[model samples]
Target: MRKWLVRRALAVNVRVKILGIALGVAVFLGGATIVFLRGYLVRVWTEDLRVRAVEIARDNASRSTDFLLTNNLYELYALLRGAVDGNPDVRYAFVLGPDGAVLADTFGPAFPADLLSVSTVRVADDAEIALLQSGHSRLHDVAIPIYDGRVGTLRLAVSEDRMRAQIGEVVAHITLMTGLAAGFGIAAAFLLTYALTQPIAGLLHATEAVGREEFAHRVDVQTTDEFGALGESFNTMIERLGVVERQRTELLKRILTVQEEERSRIAHELHDHTGQELTALLYRVSVVAEAPTLEAARGELIELEKAAARALKEVRLLAFEMRPAALRDLGLAAALQHEARAFTQLYGFAVRCHVAGLGEVALDGESETAVYRIVREALMNTAHHAQANNASVLVQARNHTLVAIVEDDGVGYDADAVLAGPPETRFGLLGMTERARLIGASITFESSPGAGTTVYVEIPIGAGAAEGADDADSSPDSG
Candidate 1:
């Protein structure tokens, strides 16, 4: 039942939830206040009523002392009647003889015999009070001795109806005030809900805009609080996403451009070098076929064989440049060494290659290719741009991970500035980053002006490789 209630409450919108909370608080506090005030007022008013009754009875007894002592029955009856008529709370007043006989009473001739037995006060006593129930009304019967009760006693009864009526009026007034307070509380709750939900609504709309690929959408920050900070964070995320999208588009264009350039270079090599060699071999073959003597034909056949060998070598070199055979035959370690040696010969810079613990690490085919291409790109950048004289490539396996580093002792340029530069200048670095991403690896570059550049690559190589790679890719330095 508790779980159901929680779920039901959570299912409501923020505005409804806030309003419900406010209403509950107002009703609880208002009801409590009303009950407390009602009880307090009743106690205070009841005490006041008792005190008023006693005072009225004492005053009547004191005034009637002379009337009773002189045996003036007319004056005494007139005095009792005047007391009853003058005060609305006094129900009736009467004087009794010392022998318990009724001397005078406001009831006149209809005075009941039971009235004498209702209350009594001794001659030495000051006053005595007793409660009497007369039909539906309750009365306080106060008895006081007149002249020390040597003459007679005065009996006065005060009704509680008037006090009850006043108490009812007070309770009604308090209830009305409580209702007004509740109304005001509800209005304040509505304003509070509006202020809170407005920012949430803005966030929801901005999220929807992001879903529709509207990268320019922004949230309006209105306060210096957590909500404002959240808006700022969301805007930062959108801006970064926009940057990534633009970089992806430019990277695609650069890839296509690089592919076309490589294809053109290959085509030119085939036509100018291999094509000429093949054509010369073919002409020598015709010469051998049309030779007049066997000696002439043997000589022509030697020249044709030489031309054929040169063409084969040219074709083999072109194929190696496209996809190295060593990579498939001897694995990643041997392939990197072969590329390093080739780079040293072509670029006139000594390139050293080192490998360790690679036999223990198991890398998938795509992962191996990505690492190789990334290292190759790093070396190319160092040779062409870093003005490096000596470079080294290191590949090692450590704790279920494969790490590679390419370092060059050259005049290094600022890595951040280069990455943020024009697309054409940063294609090599961007291409290496893209390759690492495809293989679930992370790559980073450390370089500054006049300092040697270092390229770092890390690839997970065990059962938890995918998860580890995801963590690394999400890191800030992974680019």
Candidate 2:
């Protein structure tokens, strides 16, 4: 049912409305005119028939009065018969005597018996006209007394067939006119509605194109109206979206390239550092196995132990680079402090770590890890490229948010240039941004050519904030 209704709604449009309204108006006006004209014509025709009947009856009665007074039944009957037979419009003409009996009739000796029983109406001067129905047809009867002192009535009936036929022809003509009006109305509606909806149709097409990812598709501005302005605005929006989409595409490519480079660096570090140490350890083992005396074996043993230790250290460093256990075992702050110390030792720089609210605010494990990685990456970027003497890492909860800021007083590159430039230079930044996004956080970089760089990350401590704080309070680190 819902689908059916949706289809019905979709089917409705400007063209249908215009045509329907045009046809509906035409029909309403035409029907009303037909009804009015039919009633008016019928009344006028009926009146004309009644007048004709009365006039014929009055004239015939005037001429036959003397005959009636002289008891001239032959002339009187002939006069009545002449009125009925001579006028096609007259169906019946009759004379009623003082006894209310039919004295003469055009129906001849076979005249209807019901005529004698017809109700009598007394009149003063003008003829009395009464409408009567006989079978399927209606008639107008005009009855007049022969004279003022006469005790007889002269009656004539005029069939309304001619009047009805005229009305029918007029009705036919009206129907034809109404049909013509509807056709013209529909045509005008088609033109008008099409003109109005053409712009909207273009906009719809543009929207569909946009949905299909055709961001270059634009609607034509046909006029200096609202629709034109809307079209212009829509085109502008699409153009901007196209730019953003291109930027995102480039950003994604850069992120992938950076990932490959990082993987290569890790492989290089493991192969060069750990492999050399293991090779040295194996050579030392062989030397120990081939020693001629205890003293010789003892020296090889010492070197073997040293090689093993160096190999183990390199392996540990690789493991730590992959994921530091401190992030999970101790907490985010401890992890940051450890990373800061490592960065300082590796880069020969002074690193400061300040963590407030980590012990006070309870954060979920994912949140802790995300914050830790974001800060670690920011510091690494600083150490690798900032060329700064010192850097600072701050992790705290403020204003209902967990905020981490990594800043270095160094010669910073343009943030916009790096972002809009090649992906290789900003892949790490994109990765950091993506990680922040994954944990429902926002990350931003504040930097200029010479103003240094500040990487800020904020994560909302929403539903899990209270639980995290409780967990922190119960832990040994929450002092």
Candidate 3:
């Protein structure tokens, strides 16, 4: 159940949540303030009423001294009645004799005999004030001793009903104002939340559209804040993703076309070279079978053996061209060195091989194949197109990375032109790139019109790096 509520809360709109929390906080603070103020105000007003009642009782005691000393009950009662008439808050006013007997009373004939006796309170001090319950109402009771306890005492009860009514009115006004302020605060919070979340909402919708392959969707907000910048960044990212998607589709199409072309080339080589050699060998064998003399048969058998050898060689060469067996048997380093020597012998170019740390570099089969292919393609491009003499293949390991660099002191073409040209013209380079990508490696070409071409292939050595680390450290510095 708690998880359900949490999920429900998370599902609420950001604007609604912001407003609700803000309004709730405001209402809580307002209610607390009103409660505290009401209590403080009530205390102040109640204390004021107590002080006033004491003052009035003291004054009346002084005024009724003569009446009390002369033993005139009627005059004392008139004074008490007049005091009660003047002060509307005074609920009951009376005089108490020195012996604790009621003498003059404002209630006259209706005064209870136990009125003074039932609630009699003696204080050591001359005058003492207190709040007490009287019948059905709460009263502020004040008693003042006449002549410092030599004569009767004056007592007064002030009703707190009026004070309570006033306090209630004040609190009602405060409560109403608090409620109105809370309402206004809620509205303000809503507006503020809307302003803050507008850009975020636009970004959300734009992302959803982009997820649906609508790469052109952009956030519509135009503010100059962080959200605006974020929206702009999001749009730029989507545009880049669209470009990459198109490039990926084009790359795949070109790769398929290249695969088909490679198959056709392989078929043509087998049919033209191997098939012709085998046919010639069969014809020579027929000649040997039809020979009338032993000498002629022997000569024809020798020719037939040569033709068979040629056909076997052609078939082996075709298989090697399809996938080099040297790469699998001799490892990446030895295979590269063999290819370099072969390339030098065939093309009459001075191709040098430099290998470092590869003796301990444990590369997976796929990675070795990829590196070998990249180097072979780079060298082939140099021999066919560079038209210069010196070329070098350097393979080494550095900082957990297997780095292979092929450099040629030959006339270089614009690297960017090859990269941007049609796939047919750049098929070899494209194959190298795709091969490097499959092994999670990167290939970079550095060249210009007059400068020499350099191709660098960097492969990450994730595991078994420590085995190569010592060899790499101990190896001599590379030029």
State which candidate has the highest lDDT: 1
**Global Cα RMSD, each model:** 7.5, 5.9, 5.0
- lDDT (Cα, tens digit) per residue for candidate 1, span 1-479: 99999999899999998899989988898889878977887778766776777788778888888887788899988988888999998999888899988899988679877867665433224777778889988887888888888998888888988887887788788778878888888888899898788888888998998898888998888977888888888889888887777788899998888799999999999999999998898899889989999999999988998999999999989988777777776677777888788888888788888877676235877888788889899999988988998888888777878899999999998899998898778888889998988888899989998999999999878854323221111111111
Per-residue accuracy of model 3 over 100-135 as CA lDDT, tens digit each: 888888885788665464454444365676667766
Superior candidate under TM-score, 1 versus 3? 3
From the highest lDDT down, the ranking of the candidates is 1, 3, 2
The lDDT per prediction is 0.83, 0.80, 0.82
Candidate 1 global Cα RMSD: 7.5
lDDT tens readout by residue for model 2, 212-265: 989889898888888788889999998988876765787777767768998998
**Candidate 3: deviation at residue 129, Å?**
4.4
Q: Which 10-residue window of candidate 2 scores lowest in summed lDDT?
A: 470-479
Candidate with more favorable, higher lDDT: 1 or 3 = 1
- The C-alpha local distance difference test score for the whole of candidate 1 amounts to 0.83
